[model samples]
Target: MRLLVIMSLFALSLVAARPDASKYPSRYDTVDLDMIVNNKKVLESYLKCVLDEGKCTPEGKELKAHIKEALETYCAKCTEPQKEGTRFVIGHLVKNEKEWWRKLSDKYDPERKYVTKYEAELKSIS
Candidate 1:
């Protein structure tokens, strides 16, 4: 019984620590871009996961569309502070991904497909 209770607590803690992807509101019309920008990891992971999934699966395509639209909307309404915070997070992603793409571009697309695809959008906030 004690062991069961401890394990339950551990499970709950793990779940609590995980980022909330659902925080990106379901209705795009209702999305609070600032919230997503503040919790940038969720948005970053959504973007990178879609890329990591290689643009083939239906789920990947859906996520790509959602994140792309969300980003577009965010860019339109973002204030300087929001853009600053978001740029900081996205810049980190760009740095890491750029290095990966450079190292593997010949084996990948040689055109730096992922970096090229996201770099402009990500840097637009800067």
Candidate 2:
């Protein structure tokens, strides 16, 4: 019984430590923009996690990955409103982006490339 209990706790800890990254927006295709945008709580939670300005937890990193997946997806059915809404959310999430840039100054503008490309896409929505 004692051995079983210890093993159970170890298993549980491993499970708890694992990240729960979303599996939607499969690699070959896009997901519904509304599916991500309309889910207000999830969107807010992800934004908060990514923008926390602290050491990122696994969950936060997972959320950022999922958000990136959504943002980069090629949803043909996506509407202008959904795109605008996503841009709005992302803009807020990256509002203090100078800090992010400072952290990545040595990376040769990886963040800038993504942000600038996305900004141009957003600009074409009108």
Candidate 3:
């Protein structure tokens, strides 16, 4: 009887250990290097046009806001520094997508293939 009770408790604990699937985005499973790269490219293009122009017109402001929103939506799991790195990339891309996006952005971008790559590395240390 004691063995049975212990077994039951172990099973219960295992059940509780499972992650809550509904809380995470469905895209979590599909995320890959290509998706991140594509998103980054698009984000860079959008921001470069807006910030460098400095007009701050309604349309430019709206584009900046949309880029920020998109970053938050897609990279929600990223850390503060990773997010900041992403912003830096966006800013550089806005300034010079072809020339300095890779150079001026941050070391993190070149070091990793995907945005999550940086996150994974950071999490490993912690």
Please provide TM-scores, in order, for all candidate models, with all chains considered together. Answer: 0.29, 0.32, 0.25
- For residues 5-116, write the lDDT of model 1, one tens digit per residue: 0000000011111144533222222223334334546443333444453332332233333333334344333323333333443454445444423332233335544335
lDDT of 1: 0.31
TM-score of 2: 0.32
Misplaced by over 4 Å in model 3 are: 1-49, 75-96, 100-126
C-alpha lDDT score of every prediction, in listed order: 0.31, 0.31, 0.29
Each prediction's number of clashing residue pairs: 0, 0, 1
Model 3 TM-score, all chains together: 0.25
Off by over 4 Å in 2: 1-33, 53-60, 65-113
Q: Give the per-residue Cα lDDT of candidate 2 at 72.
A: 36
Q: For residues 1-126, could you state the per-residue lDDT of candidate 2 as single tens digits?
A: 000000000000111121333222222122233343356554444334444544534433533333433333421222333344445434332343334323322122345544455446546763
Instruction: Give the winner by lDDT: 2 or 3.
Output: 2
Q: Listing every candidate in turn, what is its Cα RMSD in Å to the true structure after a full C-alpha superposition?
A: 14.3, 14.2, 17.9
Candidate order by decreasing lDDT? 1, 2, 3
